[model samples]
Target: MAEKYRVGIIGRTDRGNYGHGLDSVWREIDRAQVIAVADDDERGRWSARSRTGAERAYSDYREMLEQEQLDIVAVAPRWMNEHKDMMLAAAEHGCHIYTEKPFCRDLTEADEIVAACEMRHLKLAIAHQTRWTPTLDVVKREISKGLIGRVLEIRGRGKEDARRGGGEDLWVLGSHVLDLMRVFGGDPQTCYATVLENGEPVTGSHVREGNEGIGPLAGDAINAMYTLPEGATGYFGSHRGTAGDPSRFGIQVFGSEGVVEFLTGHLAPCHVLRDSSWSPGRSRKEWVPISSNGVGKPETLPRTGLHGGNVLAVNDLIDCIGNPEQQPKCSMYDARWTVEMIAGVFESHRTGGPVTLPLKQRENPLTLL
Candidate 1:
């Protein structure tokens, strides 16, 4: 019989909690076993232990890490503030990690997490579940096959709800879109952005503490442009109270010959429009459905939603652990790039001009304002 990988889960009761069922997904993986769980809240700790079928529970995650011989640790909290410490602790214990998104508050934290994992040769995967979806594979394959000829531009938007619109939306939801932009548009080279609050340019006075422990935030409307390699340009925008009926929150890839559109879910619908004119009315083109198998084919994956996506991600993480050469599709480095993109928007807005990638300013740009 193969050795079962021992897993530990970390969560906080009402604070972020076990994000998107990260703890429960381990129950579905046959090759892994949940050995312990940690949550500061006594009630939440026991609940997590029962939920994950963990043998033990701890109030402090650091103690759990020190006691358990864990092979993998799921830093399940959705909050960004807990991510850096949890990840570093896991790395120090020689355990691989799978954590929720909005990687960290700033590039400095991200760099520290990256360094710690690198030092330990630990594999860390972020919960950008959409990247693990089979639909993305089809999208990539179609783009490569000239279904969308010579990709020219990529655009993404966030769920601009009443509360989490603009800068907040960019950090919380736009991270997913930015990851997709990099997948299709290549590495971003430079960015120029504008941030506004009730029609006025955001200034230092506008900065305030954001939700989810995201440091200093400003702006209720944001528009950003990025330059990618090979002449591909990227754009991300969000405005408070401007979300449409169907929600204008997804990605669109425009090519010389056509365009592809996809929403932000593991099984989100994907469509391709083939038209040289790039306008459906002018060219009489219709958008065609794309599936995991291929363009217009049926999806073969039995599972769906976050559970399904986490299954795929965990399986890949296990494989990467053994292989050492492979990396999770949504690896830690990809998460870092997503953070950089989010930071670049504010950084560019602060400077009133374009800012180069691998941003020199490691702190939150709102603070510099």
Candidate 2:
């Protein structure tokens, strides 16, 4: 049996957890023991220790790193504030990483974080579990098989209640959407975004709706769009617009031959699809039947409870650590691109202009004035 990787969780409860679900993903990943947990909040520390059956809990993450000799550290809550430092600390401690999305609020910090991990020769995996989704994997493979003809426009959204998909919609919710876009469209060429934080009626009201269990976000709603390398196009819409209504959330993908409607509610279901043959008048357009293998090739993804997505990412991290040749599915470079895409959204909204990718002015979007 491969030696179990001993892991730790650093980050407190009442600050930046964002209900991210990392606490559970860590528990479900196999052979990876939770040895320690660190949280400034007394309640959070106790809660984490209770969940993982860890013997030690610390008020400071660095102290846990110094004492535990941990093999992996999950920087869960509010990772943005300490992204650079936590990564460096994990590398110095010789541990692998499984961090939250919107890797960091700052695009500039991306290079530094990537460099630190590379210098230490440590395996780093961002918390982009969507890469391991059974459906996603299948769809990607099918696209490669030329079933879709040629990839064209992709449209996706995360309109679940704020509990599922709000708060810094781009950073918290947009990470998954943008990752999916990259999967379908490849790297983006240019990005120009304009968000309406206020919904149709509440233009200036800060009552963003989607986040139900998580907490309130500063903004109301968020929307961003992208342009692809081969003239392909994509769009993303996220908002807390409807607090009382049922969650309306999912991805709608379009290709030359067909379309895919994959929604995450009810455990992320694959819905309707229409091929090139379909028309408005016809009851049955050339239906491109979506099969499990066709979604990307049917396969059972790891189910580690609600946070089942993390199991593959965690396992991959362990594998990467053991094998020098293993490259992560959500690599540091990928994380950087995701950040740039997100930053571009903020830039566009702030400047009222389209901020292209390889953004000429790369700066920290979340830095406080």
Candidate 3:
């Protein structure tokens, strides 16, 4: 904490605090103090200023970035539409960033966000906090140790919510599921997609208008599969069903010896369990707590050290800047596959054919993009 990093937070009290835990995370870092606050809504700005008590208040995020000599900027906005612009400004000033999830709304913007940060030699860490949970850590360790035996196959899905309706589940929640897949499968060699909204394909003629914004993005579900470099096949489904709609968000990993079943997100009503050939009493297995620590030593910060390990992502970004020699465990480039994973599903639906990734062309078709 010797080298304190000044920060400016582009935060909103609404939008459920960006769903990344930054509202409270800043309190844990003695070395990190928010020096400014900004939001388009005046009330949101007032709330941010009162919460962080920054010396300066702004209604425009770009203006704040121009004035504040910040070491880091936390983009904690509710929607993904503004992330590209917000982040690029931060990178232009040579500041690192901690952005909210789904990274960006589409592949076109996703690439821009990554390139903007990389061009400035800055680190970009998405708010996929489950990557740091204690339960998830155990799962990763077990997978590395072959606890699940040969690591045969993997699968996961999302429950319903307000954000559930859009075919963008892949963008919203699929990022988390796909990221976990990458953790186990390494880089994917090829990808295949199948998409449905309420179990139907979306076409250009059948425009979808959702996201609380007018557009053709409100598809209902996204389902896709990928072939990992190690020959492991992985699958992910982001269905916008209902919050309390008897939905389960978790991973089912099959292996020769055992299996690791992971529940997605740190959200409430979580039911994480594990099963294997090794049997038990009446139930094949017992309920296991889900958690995640640090995977690799991506930075000089103590393994699970920064942000007191609570906001693992924010801490990881700090460690990335503090220890430039070490690469972050997650990066924007590492996340493109996630976009590819979702887009492939849409492509499959749009073209009435199975979509492929490592796409050969690597082009985006979303006209709005």
Candidate 4:
């Protein structure tokens, strides 16, 4: 029989409610038991304990970590301000971590968390649930088989909704597509970006505190372009107070012979076009939707929605932990690089040219503004 892994959950209900069901989702994952929970707020702590069926709860996460003897801890807070400290605490206790995305406030924080987890030889999985989508594997396999020919370029977008657009949308939504781009074209070599406010270039005054502790942010509209390793171009854009008819928010891979488009969020569908000209309207080929199992009829997904994706991510964590040779699908290295891509956009805007990869400025670029 497999050993039951003791799990603890951490949250701050005042900031984004237990990281979108991350705490309770562990109940659906096998070999994991929620034994403890912690929250700064008295009410939130009780709520988290009740939701995760934890045997005990605390008002301080550090206290919970020091007491629990947990094998795993769900650092389920959406705000980036607390991520680094919480991750460090979990690492110190030799607990594997599954945390909310946007990784951390800056690359510096990301480095510390990554190093701590590495020193402990523990698995650190970011909550980029799209990496766990089963259909993504199918899309990757198809790409490997050259169904779309030689990959040439990629385009991605954020939701560009009424409430949040531009830099905020980029950090919140663009991070997902950036990760997808990495899945397709590895890490970007350089980034050149143009950021604007009211159709004019953003100035230092434009910088302001971002939502949920993401850090200083600027730009109400942005267009960032990148050069990938193999001469492939990448584009990510978002505009404030403006949206398209269909609300384009996903990644499209353009190849020499065809194209592939993948929706942004977890478990979103993907499709392939075999037209040589890569024109959907003019080409004679049809767009075929690919799924986890087949082209049209998708296989029965294990769980539904974000909870389902969380379960898959937890499974990957467990699998990686059990198998010494296997690595977590969304490892700490991957999370740090994802933050780099986001920060590189601002660095490019500041320098008036392309900013190279493995950024020199470890802090949030917006802060420099």
Compute each candidate's TM-score over C-alphas: 0.97, 0.82, 0.83, 0.96
lDDT per residue as tens, model 2, 157-244: 7654654343455566677778778877888877776555434322224433223222222344566778887778888766664533
101-204: candidate 1 lDDT, tens digit per residue: 88999999999999999898889899988998989988998798899889888999999999999999999999999999998888899999999999999999
Clashes of each: 0, 23, 17, 0
Lowest summed lDDT across 10 adjacent residues in model 3 is found at 293-302
Sorted on TM-score, best first, the list reads 1, 4, 3, 2
lDDT of each: 0.91, 0.67, 0.65, 0.86
Ranked by lDDT, the better of candidates 1 and 2 is 1
lDDT of 4 by residue, 134-166 (tens): 888888888878888888999998888877799
Among all candidates shown, the one with the greatest lDDT: 1
For model 3, the superposed segments whose C-alpha errors exceed 4 Å read: 12-19, 161-166, 212-215, 239-246, 265-310, 352-356, 360-369
Clashing pairs in 4: none
Please give the lDDT score for candidate 3: 0.65
| Deviation in Å, model 2, residue 15 alpha carbon | 2.0
**Rank ordering of all candidates by lDDT, starting from the highest:** 1, 4, 2, 3
Encode model 3's per-residue lDDT on 134-201: one tens digit a residue. Answer: 55655676668765578777776755456664465556666777777877777776666655555666
The TM-score leader among the candidates is 1
- Model 1 local distance difference test score: 0.91
Off by over 4 Å in 2: 17-19, 26-30, 160-167, 197-221, 239-248, 264-267, 277-281, 285-305, 365-369
Worst 10 residues of 4 by lDDT: 294-303
